[model samples]
Target: MTVTEKDRDILARTLWGEARGEGLAGQIAVAWAIRNRVDDGKLKSWWGEGYSGVCQAPYQFSCWNKNDPNYAYLSGAMAIPFRELAQCRGVADQVTDGRVPDPTGGATHYYAIAMPKAPAWAAKARQTLKLGGHVFFKGVP
Candidate 1:
């Protein structure tokens, strides 16, 4: 894909909102999952189109949800910490440019392990990789 500056910014904000507390590897893993969705031909109706569309799709990334705790920071209504946002932007740039290998094994979905129950969708998908506090999955119909 032809990633624009808006795409890069959206990806960076997503990384900051979703995986800021995780290590570098964890953030990249999450980014790869989003990239995987962008590459999914079957999901073009909703998930494909561009990084911004995929990341902001309703219910896809909770951090973009208005009620989500990270919404303010992600929407630019609040300031994100410089250090964390910079780290996310660096990783976003590298991964989007193919400077880093995908570590999620082609996963298109993940959820933090801390959730009380795994989502219904994950039950039908194959577990691909686990990084930091999240579990990644692929092969979902």
Candidate 2:
């Protein structure tokens, strides 16, 4: 897919919001998950159109949810820490441009390992990769 500047920025913001503390590999894993969603062939609406669409799709990435603590930084209501945001942006660019491989093995979903419990969708899905604090999954309905 041809990634525009807007898509790149949105992906970067999503990485910053979702996995900033997880470092570069974590950010790339998250990016792969988002790209996997874009290629899922299920969501055909604006929500699945491209990088921006997949990242902003409601409930897909919790960081964009109104109730999420990261929403403020993601929506520009609060300032993201400069260094963290820059790192996310750099990773976003690399992932989108194919400089990094899909380390998550086409995973379309993931959750932080610290979560009290894995979501129901993860119960039967194929675990693809584990990087930093998150675990990636695929083949979920």
Worst 10 residues of 2 by lDDT: 39-48
Per-residue lDDT, model 2, residue 3, is 93
What tens digits encode model 1's per-residue C-alpha lDDT throughout 19-64? 9988999999999999999888888797857898899999899999
Look at candidate 2 and give me any clashing residue pairs. none
- Encode model 2's per-residue lDDT on 1-141: one tens digit a residue: 789999999999999988988978888899889887877676647456889988988778889999999999999999998988889889988888888899998888899999999999998899999899999998886
User: Where is model 1 more than 4 Å wrong at Cα?
Assistant: none
**Global lDDT of each candidate:** 0.92, 0.88
TM-score: which candidate is best?
A: 1
TM-score of each: 0.97, 0.93
Cα lDDT over the full model 2? 0.88
